[model samples]
Target: MTMRRHRRLAATLTALVALTAAAGCSSKAKSGDDAGGQGADGVKTGRGVDAKAIQLGVLTDMTGVYATLGKSVTQAQQLYVKQLNAAGGVCGRTVELTIRDHGYDPQKALAGYTELEPKVLGFPQFIGSPFVAAVKQRVDGQDKGLVLPQAWSASLLGSPHIRVIGSTYDIETINAVDFLLKEKGLRKGDKLGHVYFEGDYGENALKGSRYAAEQAGLTVVEQKIKPTDNDMSAQVAALKQAGVKAVVVSAGPRQAASLVGVAAAVKLTVPVIGNNSAFAPQLLATQAGPALERMYYVATPSLPIGADTPVAKKLVADYRAAYPEDALDNGVVAGWSAAQVFGEALKKACADKDLTREGVGKALLTLNAHDAGFGMTHDFSDPQAPSSRQSAIIQPDKSVPGGARVAREPQVSDAAKAFTPGG
Candidate 1:
């Protein structure tokens, strides 16, 4: 699914320490010896920060599951770094990214983290939730570095080190179900079939489906698949056989496309709602395009890249100018917003005259109701709670700049509000 939609490590200590004198090395939050000297701005500096630049990590998928999203996310943040650097950066230190493409392999993801962990102050984008959950222990106990993942699994909540940017998977799914109910697409007696991945992302979403089903007096038809499984024929067959009125997908764009396309082929023409990572705008050009006409998905952490909002419009224009050849998607917003939040934390850290890894984490906790004119206010004060419970109900539209537009503005459903994080 959008792996953090978000997670995942690096190298030997001795070899790492050897790079300390050179530009390649970095360290965890620790004593002054491990962290380097202060910058010209007189702010205390540590790992990933030198008098000249601040290094951040980008661990993402470029050739697997979320390849399209990964590219946009990395590029958007890269654009942020460019703009920020042009503006003189935080505390006179430039922003640089140490990027690693994990290919969506868990082992490679961890290795990428390890290799880049010491070289960067923190990770602004880590693309898989399960990968993040896998290295949760290292992040909490050993690294203690800040990670702003693209993922929103409830299981990832409550961690001081890893902060999820939007409503969790369960919460978002509940909101998705609510959308179907409100639209009269589903009813009390209807069965909501949930086709989800087999890992943290899908299971977390499964929690929401069951909860919403119980609340609405509906039944949940379950179909579990893996990230590698693109064919939804069997799954759709089962869903149609079970007489499901609506469907919720908590997987990547591939799975969403397959489900919707396959569903249409089998004449199981029910409403299909997906999590944020479930749709990529590029799919609009494929054979599945017509089938996706009725597809609906949820977006959070930020609104779509092209909305009525001023910031959204500006971003769409800017991104087009920057990457004219690429297609627009929600990933650009996700990428930019994550970096925006991370930059705010850095500013706070600079203001406090402490730009260490630890300083950034502390600064981030103080950010609440942060408004970047993204049509939503994110409150990062609670680690266990999502920054925002609301998500925008979106539909695919080729006429739009990002290939989709908002159907309903961002809002939190009563059911989503009442949701508690657990499976």
Candidate 2:
């Protein structure tokens, strides 16, 4: 990571924060970490089978635009399960994680769900919004069946039967923009432009950005493009023509990279901000060197990057040990986080001598204090209990001070925010 990359990442994070804050309307205070609750399904466990094996499912994009994201998240979750099982299993029962590749498609995700419906106590999905939209009803149909979804669509948050693990784009971008504007000491009524791919992803981001602009008394110039479109010169030129001061990009890595590079080519020097969807290395690779200058991104925990925090260190080591040939990336962190959440839930489910879906859901609701032994600390409790809704800003570096190695370390925000599924 380079300094330019660092700036870019920071800018992007600012936008994400704002979005999360706006969309995360559930005002439930952070209930401190505690255990002992009933599962949603009212099922009970009496150490049923001494050798009972619990199977969890991971559905994600394995070979698509978001391939790395899904793969890394699944891998980390697998490792977490492996470690938990190695440490005597959850509640003395071994956990078996079954991963299904959905290729980021809703149809495939539904198919995967159908395949795992018979045997799974719960399923955690990491597919993009499309897959989530497709199977939204199906997953919720589990009905207090211990469903943990990673997608942050506001619509799904209304389901009390399910658990959503992250912040919504609406709140993330709104909070982020507000913070960044205040930090930068920008004047009131300034224009913040958005160049994004046209879809739910982009529209969601736009909603947040627009809300922030209205609250802060700022102006917005918006442009839409295809996520696969590589030539954003036109969009960049349009933003410049609109005299936009800041630009928020709501697209995947490839599109983001293209837009940023085009901004540089067209000499649009305004600060560039990216939403969570843009979190990954592909953007960095696309806009190396000067192009990365003043580029900032909002990174969720799944992208390990150069995280040296305890959780990150352990994850890195485990990944290296598990897949020595494959270089460590973001997906590993996602998988690890997923496992960490489930592991805690499983433990809570067994806390009161009974393990069941109702117990797991109750445990998750009241569960807090997530210190993954890494730099990551996610505790979810209160009206909205999925605690790991934090987002950090990452600025890549070209070189290190005092001749140290250049690495990517996210500069997390001082302000901690909570995200409720629909609240």
Candidate 3:
């Protein structure tokens, strides 16, 4: 997700994030004064790392709006761990995750972080922009642990610890608006309707729409909604009355579906685009399927699931075999990609002979233009910036394995590249 990052499973799906806590590590890693020792490999260890294994945290939404999406994300992360451990682990140590199912609750998310903070080295998959931001001070000031969140709000950027793996929501939204413009979803002087959440995720995206509208010579019609609100009938009515040409959805899958479905029933047909988490494969089986297929589009950093690329093929096969019941989705790719980056940093830290939290953070900065053979590549050298400012436009297609196909390749729009997240 530039999603699977914020609001209730929104952007939960601008979306890819999740995983569960394993029962325990072979043995819990030492923390505080008890942490940091020499491993058999002569690697220096610290909190979350011991002679046997290293621990990370996964604070995710499992029972909330993005439950299904979260499950897929978590499973893929688990799958990555399985593969990594089987391949001799990292620097003579196995990797473990302290996963918490926050169910998209703010208090729960905060509590989960509080509980896991001391026990883990860092968090590879914290899913909410607001939730991640909630603990930003501790992470940056005190904990100094590395974090790769599923959310993409610009507010989380400019921190050394909380590194956004993809473009932030504001930048992703700018790229999305660029997609609409290039595809003729909207032209000059057209009014582009934006339906978004009132929280960090949606508000950040709204910023981008405003900027893009100004850059592209268009008017923006705004509609604010909460994550719990599912009926988009009223919002659709308002956008229709405004005579908007295209619409941008910066919420979750449910909101997108409702808005698209409601708009269709009212014959307010128009091209609708969303941040990454706004669309999911499961929605294709619902009443919104036809409408989503006809008009709904999503912008994300990675290629859609079941893409023709080698990485996608292998992942789909392995995932389907591992969990035959779970359908393929882009969440898998997002989860795997994030986990892989974490692994890369861990490997660099291990090679540096310092698997401490700070060591891992430093290792990440050394990885510029890191490519995992997916559709996107990132430069983590600058903490103040997102790794990349690019998004691929995808359209829902029931026939595809993930129920979606790429409408555009991953690229940073001139508007997006020039735009500043906090500017």
Compared with the true structure, all predictions reach lDDT values of: 0.84, 0.58, 0.85
lDDT of candidate 1 at residue 271, scale 0 to 100: 88
Q: Point out where model 3 deviates above 4 Å.
A: 1-34
Give lDDT for model 2: 0.58
Per-residue C-alpha lDDT of model 1 across residues 68-109, encoded as one tens digit per residue: 999999999999999999999998889999899998876677
Per-candidate TM-scores read 0.91, 0.77, 0.92
Q: Model 3: how far is 347 from its true place, Å?
A: 0.6
Clashes of each: 20, 60, 21
Query: In candidate 3, what are the lDDT values of residues 1-423, reduced to their tens digit?
Result: 323333444443222222211211213343232467777778888888888888989988889977877788889999999999999999878999879999988668877876787788888888887778767765776568888988888999889989998888999999999988988558989999999988788999999999999999999999988788899999999999999999999998999999999999999888999999898899999998999999889999788886779888888889999999988887888788889999999999988998988899999999998986668889999998999898988999999888999899999999998898966
After superposition, candidate 1 runs with Cα above 4 Å error: 1-33
Off by over 4 Å in 2: 1-50, 141-143, 287-289, 299-305, 373-379, 382-390, 398-423
Whole-model lDDT, candidate 3? Answer: 0.85
Stretch of 10 with least lDDT, candidate 1: 5-14
